[model samples]
Target: MTTRSRTAGPILLAATILVGLMAGTFFIFACAVMPALSRSEDRVFVQVMRDINDVIQNPLFLLAFMGALLLSAAAAWQSRAEPHRWWTWSGCAAYALVFLVTVVVNVPLNDQLASATGSATAARADFEDAWVAWNAVRAGLSVAGLGLLAAALTVRGRR
Candidate 1:
């Protein structure tokens, strides 16, 4: 490998790891925390959902999402010249799907929930179910991306 490839390879690897961590956090929040919250009484559940809505709307989540997208894109670009180009491309595609799903489905639903009131609990519940469903899809894509990253790392190490 050339000096540039050597330098870029490590950077891309780091980016992939970082994005994986962010995606993992999101998956855990949805799968673990949200489910536990749903077990509570109606009022508590609504409040928990509202709190989750607030957390998701925060700038921190936005920053993590955007940062991960950019980093993953960079990693994908760098990987094109690597021997395991397919793994890199697959990871890129998975990450892109995750972002698209979040933007298309989750963001709108989150916005609606943000505007909802106690009187609109029924509507919120409908949206929340949809959100959970979409989140499952997101989590699956994230796992795929993480797998791709791992595969790419392994391939790179052997080269």
Candidate 2:
């Protein structure tokens, strides 16, 4: 096996784990949390979402969120000489999209939801549908990235 193959295993494994954690977190929120909140009054929805935004910023989530990108980048870098390098590169790209969507789309919506000037009804009106849509998109991207990294592991040393 090539040197890259030897190093690829661990880094790819780490990336997959982090990506999976991130994917599952987003997936759960998309499938469960938001839907459940949809039944509540707009005031409740706005309040709960604001609370979630505050609480989710903790160290553990940050570690997984940031580590997913870093390790995916490292995995892609290490896979440069491997036969399955494309898999890691693609996985990295998908995660980058996930990162971009979270920052570009979801975060702004979260901030808008956090805006104190808005009425809860108005805030929920502005935030709900768009946030849910982009969240599902990011969740899907994270899952795709996770799959690609898993594929990288599967084809690690193949010619």
Candidate 3:
């Protein structure tokens, strides 16, 4: 393969894998984590969420989440001269939407959850429903983003 194609191969692969991990993480939260947390007492729930927020900031998850964006953008840029450019570009767009939602909706809620100082009852009342609802949106967007990345990879493969 040519140098550009060779480079594109790894870029696409990394982007796809990272995006997939993000999708799976969100899916797990939607399917199990949040629901289980919902059943916990308010203090336990809030504390767990605070701990989780801290834990999720670890290097690996950060690499996957942030790397997906960087890699997707790189993949799209690398594919620009190719016929399948749209595939990578669309995938990047999908991931961008996911990022947008996370930043705009979720991060503030998380910050709020973290800052809450009063009764867990009050905290849960303020944060839980809105957080869960927005999280569901994040999960859906993550899945769609992953699918788009897979489609991009398939398109790249066919070339």
TM values, all candidates: 0.86, 0.94, 0.94
lDDT-wise, the better of 2 and 3 is 2
**Tens-place lDDT digits, model 3, residues 1-159:** 788777988998999899889888888988899999988998899999999998998999989989999999999999998777887888888888878888898888899999988899998899888888877887887788788778877877777
Better of 1 and 2 by lDDT: 2
Question: For candidate 2, what is the lDDT?
Answer: 0.91
| Cα RMSD, each candidate | 2.2, 1.8, 1.3
In order, candidate lDDTs are 0.76, 0.91, 0.87
Top-down lDDT ranking: 2, 3, 1
Q: Which stretches in model 2 have alpha-carbon errors above 4 Å? A: 1-6, 157-159
Q: Candidate 1 — which residues are off by over 4 angstroms?
A: 1-3, 57-60, 118-120
Q: Model 3 compared with the native: what TM-score? A: 0.94
| Worst 10 contiguous positions by lDDT, candidate 2 | 1-10
Cand. 1 Cα-lDDT: 0.76
- Per-residue lDDT over 33-115 for candidate 2, one digit per residue giving the tens place of the 0 to 100 score: 99999999988988899999999999999999999999999999987877888999999999999999999999999988887
Clashes of 2: 0
Mind giving the per-residue lDDT tens digits that candidate 1 earns over 1-159?
576686667766765776687678769968797788677766676667677777666677677677667777877787787797788778878988989998999888887776666555575576768888888888888888878877887887788
